[model samples]
Target: MSPRIPLIFNSRSWNWAVFAVLSCSLFSGCALLPRPRGLARFPKGTPATKAKLEQVKPGMTVAQVEAIFGSPGHTSKGSSHDNPPFLSWTNEDLTAAIIMFENGRVTQRMNAGGLK
Candidate 1:
């Protein structure tokens, strides 16, 4: 049988292998760091500001409004194609905003409870 080769940790090749593994493990650790909360794209249960509500305008679609303010908290009784179906959103403080839709497009917007 052939003689088995010995591994010497002091050798240059062994030192390079150790260094490469350490460098890779150190760099990979950065990926596990937590991101800052302020950078969140969408925050849940956030109050709608007046400026956000103002983004809703006449002629915008129901889907478009939902994209801006999320889903409506309340919907008036009417069919989707009704002459003036209403959609409304309310914050925890009871500040509320309303939108009127006709033919699947915005007709008007109203707000109450000092939205700002």
Candidate 2:
């Protein structure tokens, strides 16, 4: 009886192996990676300081919040069901400033790491 050749030695199998490797490398580059979500090291706008964050009120408008915290480092567009549009700010110290907006007004505010 003749022995069967290994599957990897077949041309079809070899092509699939090369395709898989190229696919992985193509998608793994930094160009396809999401940007780092953090505060700008040197902010060109208003800084997210403890004092500024304190001024954010639940009823404030988006413009009002922006006035206090400046442009957010990250802005997430939320859905209507459970999520709402939100803004985020961060600092070099890893302190995070987040604000949720509903109907274009502030609905929630969260601070983690306690900005100083």
Per-residue lDDT over 52-99 for candidate 1, one digit per residue giving the tens place of the 0 to 100 score: 789999999878887888654433334654454766666544456667
In model 2, where do residues sit more than 4 Å from their true spots?
1-45, 71-84
Candidate 2 per-residue lDDT, tens place, 1-116, comes to 99987677667658546744543454344235556677444355444677877899998987787777767553435565334577667654446677777788887676655667
Model 1: how large is the Cα RMSD against the reference?
Answer: 23.1
Q: What is the C-alpha RMSD of each candidate to the true structure, in Å?
A: 23.1, 15.2
Model 2 clashing residue pairs (backbone): none
| lDDT comparing candidate 1 with the true structure | 0.64
Reference-based lDDT, residue 26, model 2 = 41
Give residue 47's lDDT in candidate 1 (0 to 100).
60
lDDT to native, each model: 0.64, 0.63
